[model samples]
Target chain A: MNVAKHMLFPDVGEGIREGTLVKWLVKEGDPVKEDQPIAEVETDKAVVEIPSRDHGTVLKLYGKPGDVILVGKPLMTVGEPGEPMPDAEEAITESNEKKVEVPKKEASAAPERILAPPSVRAAARKAGIDLSKVSGSGPGGRITAEDLEKAKGGALAAPASTHQEKTLSFDYGKGKRVPLTHLRKTISERMSWSWRHVAHVTYIEEVDFGALKELRGRNKPKAEQMGFKLTPLAYMVKAVATTLKQYPRFNASLDEEKAELILHDEINVAVGVDTEEGLIAPVLKNADQKSVFDIAKEIGGLSEKARARKLSLDELRASTFTVTNIGSVGGVLATAVLNPPESAILGVNRMKDRPVVRDGKIVIRPMTYLGLTFDHRVGDGADAARFMKDLVEKLENPAWMEKG
Target chain B: MSRKKVFEAQIEYLQILDEKGNVDASLDPKLDELTLKKMYETMVRSRAMDKKAISLQRQGRCYTYVPTEGQEAAQVGSVMASKKEDWMVPAFRENAAYLAKGVSMRTLFLYWMGHEEGSRFEKDQNCFPVSIPVGSQVGHAVGLAWAAKIQGKRQAAITFFGDGASSEGDFHESANFAGVFQIPCVFICQNNQYAISTPRARQTRSETIAQKAIAYGFEGIQVDGNDVLAMYVATKKALEKGYAGKGPTLIEAITYRIAAHTTSDDPKRYRDEAEVEAWRKKDPIARFQTYLKKNGFWNEAYEKEVQEKAAREVEEAVKKAEGFQANPEDMFKYLYQDLTPDLRQQMQEMKQSLEG
Candidate 1:
């Protein structure tokens, strides 16, 4: 008796063209039930588990993890035990052929860091030779396919090994060696990565805090009634978001792999919170669309959640720009490191009563320094100056805050 | 000269059944036992299917779905008021209306599952495919009614739209055309308080959506959409007027979208949770069930049977829909009576690629 096989196709979400096969829950020949989750597929929006449409033994697993499956493409085949396989092999082979062709083309188009021809590089890849180690005999140290053949089965034939540098030890020997927490390790890795990749140019601007102070004082009682302290950081975030609308370059991310700059539509300002464990930035999503009072309350809640180590992943991601307040810590002025992907970060430092010449006479005014560290890859120092000037003007004349 | 009132218009509000499930006996349509039971069962099925569809979308079995959780009475009641010959033109969120008009649950599920085959209804079903562009279907509905009128058919056309559609120029144009031609049409606006994030208040400055019909020279009335009896009475009256060769009538059914605008939306972003909680009390299904029980048309056993039957039907439909094998060739077929030269070449190429 001939039994038909049931193919499980993807129906992840609307307008989702394709998804990455994250994992398969069931292997071939395993019996599965209807509506049983068969595989985890990551779509453009989120990771979703695609369930089996019929109860039967899994006949064929279509693709492995990291495989790109198009929408409406069958992920697997299920059929009765001892059933003969149908003509699905052709479709599977077709998809596999397409996937195989993509990577070969991408590898050939890689940046020309090493001096080698495409054919020679392909031969080196097949022979498992680290071409970078082979001293080329050609002009300008170009490795030929002949050199690759000669290097095969030799010391340079092995897969590229990671650089293992030795660390110099000091004789102090009396300090405790506590392992870094996951958060600390993550922060360290991200900061170092940002520092290495970003072309950072920080610009500092001095602004009078008279208008901002007066505005905060006027709203302080109202904010207190709403059960949260109205900090200057809220005003700074609001001002930054407002100014970012004009300076679109600052409210963007650099896609280094794609060599593109993505201008974010929403101004999600991730405010840096110094918790007991380390520092974490919880995003106040769509800060430009929100009122200062709402931002203040959200900041308070986010700080509480951050201190309690209870911030959700959604709250910690998709921040277009970052704001770090060094006021409470009493910093005169500080340049902050750029958050990875984000084009810029604003560091607001402590306020001070400084003597300034006003109308040719010396006078005391409350002032603060605003530092803007931006990715020069996205903009220049002149653009950063303009952004800072706009921000400083907004901070000094903050009558717009009352428009809320 | 002394000032005189040249013209005056008043919008009528009708409510046969209160929120507490008490029906005014004088205003009740007095539907037969089987018809009443069918109406209630259809609403319950719509609700069950809506819940299941949302779950399916979350589980990645279905795509984004526009749920009809709170506006079932408005949909079922209005559809039940029309005859089988009447045309049902619907916007996207009319799953209840479609179900009542003899469109299968499997078809709707398949459509939301991202299949074009789902939109191709049975030949006898006079319901149009789901329209995505807001208020764009109003013109098609008016055209359908105009065609019927030109052909000397007595069947009236009924269109379903949301409060957001009321602001669309298509709706205004269609209403004006319908009124000028005295076309046999019934326009039902499911004023579910929101069009995505834009609330009804922001959609228009009109004091009431029903009053807008006065400008188009038609009688418009508002009804408590959650009250099945009120919706049934109002729609019945409007359809009667439509079939009697009188001009079109607009029925503004006041309701709320208890769920998100669609599966992808987050109502919490714009709407208050307390508002949803309050609307939950006025749920159409629950309210109708109470009315049915008080009228001796429903009991626990019947309710259990209806619910179990709906659940079973929905599961079977879902199973059938998921098992459907859509042919790639169908994409090229049915779009035109004869494929153009360019389309034929593309089809051949697609077929060759697939076979390869």
Candidate 2:
């Protein structure tokens, strides 16, 4: 008796949904060795060659080149060559398919389309009503803001008032319509999703970059010899990664359904690189284990690859935290959106010459703003502020950079 | 006593049709009128599709797309020479090659739209997905050919790359492997003069990219890439040699990148317009059209009909591509054969957030 095993496209990257079958190294009916590359699949960020785990004949291949295989869908079947395969119905109801069906709740039916103005729609959304159920009494059977208010009042058993809010409409001139690129679309969706799910609280602190500037100046030559230019951002990455060990919440992601915080063991810092396409955050993996100079070198290489659209899927995924240097673009401060699955993001602003009180005397110092935007679901405002305070203290003094 | 020279590589350049559209009858491959016309039509269709993709990019309907405007002959001609069963390993800029290989226009559009389904091909197709990491596909082609050789298969593998790719270590390694194994493979390099802002001259100090094949112990040749007849004849000869077990050969098709490196690049940043205008006079499609007209294979009515058909096909593909409901979670799927512990955790988190 021969038992056929179904192979599904694995979840290779963080939240990846599909992959394109680039090539099948083995043909159907061919005998394959274990650990042989059976197929190559191109995901969003990389072309991954999948290896066979078991030694078996290629019983059946599901997709051809250029066909997108969904995750959890059968990619191939491995069994004895020329063996009679199971029927389709049996395959469909297999254990792997059952796992895919387990989490799928019956989708709530979409609300019916209602013809309403912007203000009325806003009112309906604010009141949390199924707009399709509401009847309109305005012109041409249109739902007005008054109608939404009355519907809300009736639902709550409250008295309806005669007060009407004025709705404003403006004419905007036509301009060129630009379609969003894939990166832009992803950015837009992710940002909005972050805003909707994560309660964001940003804490800003001013840090003196005087000590950092001196350290960078002293180490610039040594860094150059090691094939990397020392920058303030590298030092900040080190400081943030070190401080994360003390405040684990900032380095964690919240699984709201399970109400669990995932504290990552390795410090994977994502650095934002601006490209002609859009902003991409490439990860500097295992940053906690790397020295400041090593981080600097990796940053240089990763940024170049990111800008060239050459980053691999591994570089694009599994970022435990993010650091964006608005200072490179000359911004004083910016509150960055939390890259979800990661609870917090650090934004470093430009250092400017400012008057500072040194021993009761006014002195010029290079001061910069550091903004920490965190998911309030994971931590409180006080905790977020403390993380920033620790980061600032480490930056203001150069001892941490030397010690670690 | 003086030592005699052991070997010298002679680089032969093939040009059946000149820039003036004048064909050398003696050098012509003597293809049937119908096949020649089909080749011409395919080039036009490829150009039409490219134009549509660029317009789509400008309209924000597609992602960053690389246009194959001026080098249609090199792509179409080389692909036309291969048998249907032969393998084709292409770089990201091989729109014409894909078209010639019977890849649907909708699939191309879907790919530019960032859909994974676009890259998936049917079981019969021997073409690989567009390799984005420059010259990396060369090694895959070599390995594929080696596999065929070991399996006693008669099929040959043709790999496409650029002058910029020839500078990569992967290309040299693949060339060396192909030479050592004596596998049936053809390396076609479209020397399109520029890799982004870097010129071909800066890519290599060698007088000709074709000469680089000599060090790997293989024959290499050059051809006027804009001349379809020359490209076709050279590729046919190379494929024949591969089938005859004469090992791999590299063909350097001298061409120009008429468009920017990609939609995201600005050619004006580094290149001069006058230079572009000069290349326009030697456009592959225009020159091919002239040849077809001389052969009585093309007329005003036929040209118009072909263009209309191409436009209609491209529009239909655009529609089909737009019909896809791209799921964001699709990115996380098919990343591996099985989810690792970390990936499983990430998926659970993603599912929860999406649910909320």
Candidate 1 lDDT by residue in tens digits, A1-404:
76645454545465556776767999998999866878876555345667776678998888776567766556777788778766766545644553313234445877546889999888888877778887687756788766675566355434532232235887978796555545666799999999988998889889999888988999899889879999989999999999999988999998889999899999999999998768999999999999999999999999998886656567888999999987876868789998888999998889999998889999999988888999999999999988888888888889989853
lDDT of each: 0.85, 0.83
Please provide TM-scores, in order, for all candidate models, with all chains considered together. 0.60, 0.48
Q: What is the TM-score of chain A alone in each candidate?
A: 0.61, 0.59
Q: Score the docking of each candidate (DockQ).
A: 0.09, 0.01
Model 2 lDDT, residue B342, Cα: 86
lDDT of the structure predicted as candidate 1? 0.85
lDDT of 2 by residue, A1-404 (tens): 77777765655544466777767989998887645677877666455556664578888898776567776667778888666776655656663432433233433454445788988888788888877888988744778876787788778773443343435887757985555545677789998899879888889999998988888888898888877788778898988998888988888899989989999888899999988767899999888788998899889999998876667666788999999988886866789899988999998888899999999999999999888999888899999878888888888888768632
What is the Cα-based lDDT of residue A237 in candidate 1? 93
lDDT of 1 by residue, B1-356 (tens): 79999999998898887887888889888888999999999999999999888767755578899999999999999999889999999999999999999999999999998788998999879999999999999999999988988898888889999999999999999999999998988999999999899988899989899888899999999988888778888887887887788879999999999987887665655777788999999888887787888889999999899999999999999989999998767778767999988889877866666665
True contacts kept of 1: 0.16
